[model samples]
Target: MNARDPSLPLQADELSGLADFAASAWDEEIVPALTDYIAIPAKSPMFDADWAKHGYIDRVTRDAAAWVESKKVAGLKLEVIRVEGRTPVIFFEVPATKSGSTDTICLYGHLDKQPEFSGWRSDLGPWTPKYENGLLYGRGGADDGYAVYAAITAILALDKQGIPRPRCVGIIESCEESGSSDLPIYIDMLRERLGNVSLVVCLDSGAGNYDQLWLTTSLRGMVSGVLKVEVLTEGIHSGDASGLVPSSFRILRQVLDRLEDSKTGRLLPDSFHCEVPAARVAQARATAAILQDEVWKRYPWSCGADGAFTLPTTTDPVEGLLNRTWRPTLSVTGVEGFPDLGNAGNVLRPYTAFKLSLRLPPLIDGNEASLKLKTLLEDNAPYNAKVTFVPDGRAGALGATGWNTPELSPWLDQALNEASNAHFGAPLGYIGQGGTIPLMSMLQKGFPKAQMMVCGVLGPKSNAHGPNEFLHVPYGKRLTAAVAQVMAAHP
Candidate 1:
């Protein structure tokens, strides 16, 4: 049997000690630690000019590293690792117990957050952490801040029970919210320092609901660019330009109309290629069976009591879920040419630009998609307008398949099932998240043979990256217990 297999069985006393440790450590300590962590406003570099100057990121990283070190688990040493021009990654490890008996397991998470957008309800702020109605509220509470606490709590609980831990390394990066631009450089620098790892546990993703354990089977890649259209050299009176010259705004709208079907919110011109994988469709069907009602209820608007969208026929809940997670989607995130209230005028603006963010399917090639999109936009320019497509960012999707570790899956499933049953009074379902985790792809490339398991606590309506983002405290505690159970099961 492999070291992480819980089926091997723990002695009665060991199990009892673990249960007790989980109750004290997680209930009293870890939850509070997460609360404190959520208070830091370590927005991603794109969102903040003072990410380094404010020192919030550095402060939080050091605080987390110190907390891990204070645990003092036997054979475990904690340290902060930094590479020039990149954010610091907090690294800690519990050394292997005996030759050929223990294998290293890596845990990954991030500490950065997206800028808080407007439209929040009263009593919510970007940085201030709040707790209300069983949820812990803040920006980074769910997206990633909780992972470091969860990793430490799980390992420490095992140590308290005197169980030998598999050699484990916990890596917490600080810039994921900015698309993890610095990750590649940091990985190259630590390539030699980080040795062979058998399995990786990424604790930064979403759950289908409070009752389910979600695994991201595939992630859609993303490409973002700005589409600019220019007609006149300078602004002109609308009265003069109306009949003589085409309005730049009207022309810009015409160009965009060809790219998407506004009435249906679907992409047009057939530029994107996305086919839902058979496995992903099947998984979504299974998830929909249990979560359909909850999913509908979470939406701000409901279609009567059924909450179904208007289609010719009834839409399958599974298909709706699949569309978001596995298919390609495009959205115009921002417009640069439009003026605010005070700048209102009757003159036709000479230039207009809009930011387009496209989410590509797992099988789609990011570069190819970017090039095709650019060609389409340039070729379709109206009135012989000066059109330009400036690439912003691109990341290819990562597919999670194969490399199933003999030691991890069964234990994780069992522990998660037991915890879900106890907390939500139901069986936990597995689902895939639509969001991207660039680190997972990086790790897979570095450790080609490593088995990977991705799971986390965010659920529907958690509003991660949106206002009023929160971490459910009760759910988080239960998740911590589940992690402890997995550790006890691990050899």
Candidate 2:
């Protein structure tokens, strides 16, 4: 359809007005708010032993609630809802216009962030917001802080134009970075308060590129556990025990070898067996076509003898995308047996442990997979070593089939296609994201009938949950405008 198409009612005037509003407000208003929002070190509750001690979470929540209140959208009520001692949740609503027209649209995002890991450039700090080369750099800038701004900005922009809106509820959580520990309790408490909702939007995902609007069709669930192997009572000098004693590290490696193929990076355990869905495979092919040249080059580090670890030359691009989005994967994230640099010595450690992080397919049962993984690892331990398995967290994967919401597919495709065509000269493509958004599953449980649209400003090389994290300001502004378009076009 052309830009002037009457059926898709987003006129050039409306688009220009929204884009202009976003550009001006983002620079003069959103940037300052984001700067202050990023300044607070509101680490997840899991990272901080006493989250309330520093008052960072509270401070950020209050700041977000204040921003929402300042919007003053007609018929919208904003407030911070607190449960017992858990982190506060900012809730705001734009009531529906007429009777039986109250179709609630709940928007979700988080205010808290993962612990800021080390290895940052000299100019960038975790809490300090720095704008450079069209990027806003800081901890919470991309992963979540932008959501609160984006949702409010979009709704308020529409309200400024006097567009009547559905009952839009924005729920910004304070513990999303920590697996949303207290969110369920908060949801239960406010279950009655939050009435029937028809649509949901989660802005905590990444876009494929700044030029295109990416919609995630599925999310892989995460299961984290510790694998421990005890081979001896105490460390022994390598000179004396090198030939006689079995190394705990070697035994740990053997057990891990059973679960993962060392050469192919494929999980060998049988418990994680779920075939990629047909629709996702098709989406992957499209994504591969779009990302052919940029995907490999986007890697931060150079590859070894195996090249860039991409799909085989013969493999279809669609298969490559399917592998990442719909398949299960495993990685050893941390080792407990490694010694500090200063304490390193030629000694065989008696006990070794490593943190195992497994990504389950969208249809796989996380708990069952975790149990199967533990059994496989323990059974594979060499030298009859003592083994222990400790599970840390598990979240079920989420998938949205077109069959569940047939009306949504075409709406999303059109909205995204229109937005992409306006910004870049191309149609927007869909893909599945590998990262876990714990709240998706939770929201589905609480609001089973809600149709969701998961889109965000994070793009390739944005590097969320890592040092030098940044948000593309211009792209973000455009993305917010796209969100406005999508909301306005919602049926």
lDDT of 1 at 121: 70
Candidate 1, RMSD to the unseen true structure: 4.3
lDDT, candidate 1, residue 373?
75
| Residue 165, model 1, lDDT | 56
lDDT value for model 1: 0.70
Lowest summed lDDT window (length 10), candidate 1: 397-406
TM-scores of the candidates are 0.86, 0.89
**Model 1 lDDT per residue over 302-377, tens place:** 3555777534212567767766666667778788877887997988888889888777666666667777777877
Per-residue CA lDDT of candidate 2, range 46-119, in tens?
Answer: 67868898999999888888877787767678778887778899888777532345577788899998887888
Residue 326, model 1: lDDT of 65
- For model 2, the superposed segments whose C-alpha errors exceed 4 Å read 1-8, 97-100, 303-316, 379-381, 394-409, 422-425
lDDT values for all models = 0.70, 0.75
| The candidate that achieves the highest lDDT relative to the unseen native structure | 2
